[model samples]
Target: MTAKLEKTLGAVSLWGIAVGLVISGEYFGWSYGWGISGTLGFLVTTIIVAAMYTCFIFSFTELTTAIPHAGGPFAYSRRAFGEKGGLIAGLATLIEFVFAPPAIAMAIGAYLNVQYPDLDPKIAAVGAYIVFMTLNILGVKLAAMFELCVTILAVIELLVFMGVVAPGFAISNFVANGWAGSNEFSFGTLSAIFAAIPFAIWFFLAIEGAAMAAEEAKDPQRTIPKAYIAGILTLVVLALGVMIFAGGAGDWSKLSGINDPLPQAMKMVVGHNSNWLHMLVWIGLFGLIASFHGIILGYSRQFFALSRAGYLPKSLSTLSRFKTPHRAILAGGVIGIIAIFSDGVVNLQGMSLTAAMITIAVFGAIVMYIMSMLSLFKLRRSEPNLNRTYRAPFYPIVPGIALVLAVLCLIAMVWFNQVITLIFLAMMFVGYVYFSMTKHQRENAEEDLMLVGDNH
Candidate 1:
C-alpha cells in the first residue's frame, strides 16, 4: 500500500530543515580536519574539499529531482535495484541517522561543559538528547518549526563568526604553512590534497536532506531542487568564510585542541575580556544545538521511508494519527542513547561509529547516484515523455560528471579508510542476506494466500 503523506513541510520549511543543525558539525568537522592535515596550504586543501562537496551535492540533486521520494537514499536504491538493494541502502542510511544524535548531544554537552566547567558533561549530554527526543516525538511539523528557530539562530551565529574574525585577517598564516614537504612541485603536495578530500566532503553533506521532505514540500519538484541548491551554496559560502576567518584570526598551529574555534578566534583577536566574545560563544553554543536538531530531522525521515518500504520493521513504518513515524523516531533516539553511553566508556567508540557510518552513508549515496543517473538515462531512452518539471542540465553531461566524481570520492574513502569501510560493507552484506531471506518468506506467504483464495 502507498503511504499517506502529510503536507507539513513547504519549500521554505524544507530549506529550514537543512539549515538548522548541520552547521555546527560541518564547521567543527572541517576545522578539525584542516587543523589535523596542517601540511597542505589552506587554500589548496579547501579547494579540494569544496570540489568533492559540490559534486556530491550535484549528484544528489539529480536523483532527488527525479524521484523526490521521502525515502531519500533508501527509496532511490529500491527504485534502482529493487527490494534487496533497498534493504542494503536502508541499513547504511540507518547507521548514519542512528549514530548522529548521541554524537551531537555529546557535542552539546561538551560545549556546555566548556562554559560551566562544573556541569556533569555526561548528564548534560543526556539531557540534550532527551530534549531533542521530545521535540522529534512531538511530530515532524513541530520539529520543522523548532528547526526554523534554530536555523535563524545558527545564521546569526555564523554572521557573528564572520564579523568577529574578518577584521583579524592575516595572509601569512596560510602561506607560511606551505604544502607539506613541497620543493616547488612534488607528490607530497598532491598527498595533502588527497588527504584533505574526505574531511572536506564531510562538511558539505546533507545537501540532499531537503528531498526527504519532498512529499510534504509545496511543489516539491521545484522546491526540493531550489532548497537543495540554495542550502548547498549557502554552506559553501559559509565554509569558505570560516576557513578565511579562522586562518586569519590566528595561526592554525594554535587553533588545535580547541573545541569552539569561532569563539576562540574572537577571544584571540578582540580579547576575552570583551563582552562580544562572550556573546558570540553563547550564540555559537546555540548554533551547535540547532545543527543537531536539523540532522535528526533529515535522518529520521529516511528511517521512516525505509520502514514503510518493508525493508525495516513494520512497527517503525507505522505513522501516528498525527502522521509522524513515532516508533522510528524513538528507535533513532534509543540508538542515540546507546551512542552516548558508548562514548562515555571509550574515547569515542560510538563517535567512531558515527564517523564510520557517515563514510558508509556517502558510499551508499554514491552508489545510488550512479544507479539513479543510469535510471535517468534509461528513462530518457524508454520513457521520453515522463513528466519531469526539472531536467538535469546538459542532459547526460552534468549527470555524467557527477557520477564520475562520486565514484572517485568513493574510491578515495575506501582506500584511505579501509578498515572502517570494510566494517560498514560487512554491515550492508548482513542486511542483504537478511532481506533476501525475508523476501523468500514473504513470497511463500503470498503464494499460500493465493492458494487459499483459489480454494474458497
Candidate 2:
C-alpha cells in the first residue's frame, strides 16, 4: 500500500510551526545587517522587507487554502505554469529550506559556546542536525508539539530580553552612525539600505513554510488562514521590538557580524557574569532550536512531496514505520551538515559563512515569493470558480505589492552578493539538468503506477 501523511495538525500547531520556522531570525543572522547598513539604514531595510512579507503572507494564504498540498509553491506553480515552473519553484524552495538550517545551526552552536567556551561550535552544530533530524523522523505530532513548546518559550525569552534591556535603550546611541556612510540620507545610505535587504528579509523568511504542513493540517482551509495571519502579526511585533531594543542597548556595532547578538547585547547591560546574561544565553537557544527543528519539518515535507511526484529519487518518498518521511529528513540533514562544515572553505567576498548562507537562502526565498505571487495571479484567472475558503483581502493590490517587493529584493541581493548569486544560479542549473534527464522516466513510471492502481 502507498503511504499517506496523517492529518493531525490544527490551527494552533500550524501557528507554532509558522512562528517556529522563522523565529531564529529573532535570535541572530539579522545583526549582519548592522555590519553593512548600520542601525538606521538596516532599520529602513527591515521595514521594507517586513511590509513585503506581510503582503506576501496575506496573499499566499489564499493559494495554500485552495490547494492544500505538501508541495506548497511547487504544486501551485506546476498547476499554473506546468512542469518547468514546478521544477523552478521546487528547486527554489529546496534551496531556501535546505540552506537556512545550517545558518541556524551555526547560531545554535554560537549560543552554546557562550555557556560552554570549551565546546567546538561546529561539533555542536552537527550534533543539532542529528538530534532534530531524529525527532522529525519519529512522527509529525511529536515534532510539532515540541515545536509549540519551544516557540512559546522562545517568544517569552525575546519579551524578557526587551524588558531587561528597556532601561538601557538610549535613543541617541541607536541613532548614532545609523546611516552607513553618513549621518543623513544620501546616495550612499540608500545603497547600504538596499544591500541590507537579505538580512532584513531574514526576519520573516520562512513564515510561509507553514503551508508545507497543509497536507497534514486538519481543515486546512479554515486553519491555515488563522495560523498564517496570526503568525505574521506575531513575528512583525517581535522583529521590530527585538531589533529596536537590541540596537538601543549599547554600542550596536559590537553586536554586528556575530552569531550571538542577543546575549552580547544583554551582557552589555547586565555584565558578563550576571544571571540574566546566562539565562538569555541558555534560553535563547530555544529560539534557535524552534526554527531549526521546524525548518527540518518544512524541508522534509517538500522533499517527500517532490519525490512522491517523481521529481526526485523515489526512495526519498518512503515513510518510516512511524509514518514520517525518514529518508527526506536525513537527506536534507546531510546537505545542511555539509554546509555547516564548509564554513571557511566557501568564501563569498570576505563574508562569513553564516552571512553567505543567509544570502543564498534569501535569494531562494525571493525567487519563490515571486513565483508564488505569479501563481496566485495565474490561478485566479485560470480557475475563478475554484473554492477559496478565504480570499486575499485586496486581490491584485495585495499580491502585486508582494511581487514588486520580491523582485526588488532579488535585484538588491544579486547586486550586493554577486559571487553567492552565481552559486545559487549554478545550483538551480544543475537541478534543472537532472530534471530534464529524468522527465521521460518519471512519466513512464506514473503511467505504470496508474495502471496498477486500476487493476487493484
- CA lDDT of each candidate? 0.63, 0.91
Q: Give me the overall lDDT of model 1.
A: 0.63
True-vs-predicted CA distance for residue 187, candidate 2, Å: 0.5
lDDT of 1 at 407: 71
Please state the error at residue 380 of candidate 2 in Å.
0.5
Q: Write the per-residue lDDT of candidate 1 for residues 1-456, one digit (tens) a residue.
A: 545567777767777776664576544555545543552444565675566456556656656666667777666655555556556556766665555556557666666776788997668877886787678767778888888777777777787777877777777765456455332536656655655554565566555566677766667777777776677777778877776777677666665434556666777788867788767767776667776777676667877776565555566757777777777777777767776676435442233433444454555555555555555565566545545677676666766776676677667667766766776778778877777666633343212211111222
Badly placed stretches (over 4 Å) of model 2 are 444-456
Q: Judging by lDDT against the true structure, name the best candidate.
A: 2
Q: Among all windows of ten consecutive residues in candidate 2, which has the lowest summed lDDT?
A: 447-456
Superposed on all Cα atoms, model 1 deviates from the true structure by an RMSD in Å of 4.8
Name the weakest run of 10 consecutive residues (lDDT summed) in model 1. 446-455
